[model samples]
Target: MSTSAQGPTSDESLTPVRWGVLGASNFALTVSLPGMKRGPLTQLAALASRDIGKARDAARSLGIPKAYGSYDELLDDPEIDAVYNPLPNHLHVTWTARAARAGKHVLCEKPIALSAKDAEALVDVQRETGKLIAEAFMIRNHPQWQQARDWVRGGQIGDLVSVQAAFSYFNRDATNIRNKKEVGGGALYDIGCYAVNTSRFLFGREPVRAIALVERDPEFGTDRVTSGLVDYGGAHLTFTCSTQAVAYQRVNALGTRGRLEIEIPFNAPADRPCKVFLDDGSTLNCSSARVTSFPTVDQYHLQSEAFSRAIRTGSPVENSIEVAVDNMRVIDALFRSVESGRWERL
Candidate 1:
């Protein structure tokens, strides 16, 4: 799949992908657009929105060269080589397919689709277009995560046992996309995915089953809080994500001999060094702790660079659509478990 957008000609191998964003969502303006500018093989070339005024405003503020009144117009631009879809969660599949069919590689936002079945629809399109399509799970590109995985694999924690995680924030604004159920709003789809993705990342295996306790917002009809347990053979991962709660996040990975605590597990601050603590559990305190820090970096920039490199050099993607599908399957099972009041096999 990575080779679908085969490496460019010899002379074009080092060329940056002229990235055109589909919308000027707040996340795009405040985070992705700026980070995308720093990529080794990415360019903030254009931005488009259904509203011409919105697109032009975003383009001017971000110094993007072209602004389009419609997504189709930007897709038709000959100089553009890739597209980033930060549209609402519900639109990820439709827009990604459109971008691919228009002869452009695509990097779409997380929760690539509302369901595993919806995500599967892209497989045929990807194969048919021979285009590189990747979900934007920027965390996978962070060096801290890589280092954490290393410690797990290298036995720094001595045989991974379980991963305990929690991510939450108070957001009740009915107007916010994260609160709109029809467009795929909810704690599970928005943040619980990190728990599933990273546990799978560290376990290096799929979970055999899953179960969850979900609490929905009466007004929004969306899961405001969700806690799920996944069984990876003999190992386990317990995580809770919330859309309405005190703002906080952390992840702890425990093993037979030691444990690792990721301080800023999900929303890693880009302006400062990221740290992870290792504890041997000898004293049950800080005395047995070791600290590891990674220099300041924006995960989004790294994500863009990796995808662009894969496009320009025929390299592998850090996380592909197949990975997204597996993740969705776990999430799908969790949702079913809520209804059935029992564990659902993955």
Candidate 2:
């Protein structure tokens, strides 16, 4: 709760921001943790989990200097300037609020809350503490997405007409957290959020209404597949996501004069180059499409660096709590539409 508008320390202005992880989730281990270690703007200071042994083992294996038995201990560490919350969807808001109250900036995992109302509560916490809290939407930091957004905004794709996207992965494990409804598990809450977020990001606005159809798994009580549509005035966004299908993802944007396609839309590879395909209406064959390949870049590193810069300079982040809330509002409407069998206004 140190709400003082103090600037970064003189040394910290030249050094990396000391960062801690709230949990030893696989994503933190494989993606965010490595990103922190590699990024010049962040220091992998510590890690904490409910199980002390696991925390210690992970810290040792990851070369982190400190390990805590509890998340509170990590948050209370005066040396840690920020904490990454890779907890479950339901725990995102709680731990993020705690981190902010402990005078630490937060880069929380996506779908920052299960609902719009909960997202609003987190926004309130940010307002009260004046801390730099951002939902960890790493796609926003990817060069592919940045270029796509720029092209769309720069009128390279002409007037936007529609967006079509799909994301799926086969995960049949009954005990997986994504299969548990109580923890905010579902196809929509998992991969579908990315599709929705991408649409909103490229469109640069929220939908006016939404409709969705979902099929749930009987044993897991989680949506196995879902298809949704969002009305954005003259333009529309359509997406389908599934947990029971083959792993695949693609996003295409259609406009009056041309189209934009992302070959590796959501799960971008960090070690290999990724391409964005653009096609002007002048050509009739697939060979007419132009390809732009981005070099090997770790988006998680970019995200961490962006958050660190915001904390160091008191600047705004790309994925603000308000953006999360708006995304959740569209998600809430989609769920309502699925239940009511009609379009739900946002």
lDDT of 1 by residue, 1-346 (tens): 0111111222235987899999999988998778888765788899999999999999999989899999999999988999999999999999999999999999999899989998888877889999988888888888778888988999998999899999999999999999999999999999999999999998899999999999999999999999999999899999999999999999999999999988998788879888888889887757778877777888887788889889988888877888888889999999999999999998
lDDT of candidate 2 over 1-346, digit per residue (tens):
1111111222345568999999888878887778667777888899999999999999998899999999999988999999889999999999999999999999999889999999999888989998878898898888889889989999998998999999999998987889999999999999899988999999998889999999999999899999999999999999999999999999999998889999998888888888888889677775768888787777788888888888888778889999999999999999999889999999
Per-model CA lDDT versus the true structure = 0.89, 0.88
Residue 312 of candidate 1: its Cα lDDT?
87
Best by lDDT: 1
| lDDT accuracy of residue 49 in candidate 2 | 95
TM-score of each: 0.95, 0.95
Which runs of model 1 end up more than 4 angstroms from their true locations?
1-13
Candidate 1 RMSD to the correct structure: 5.3
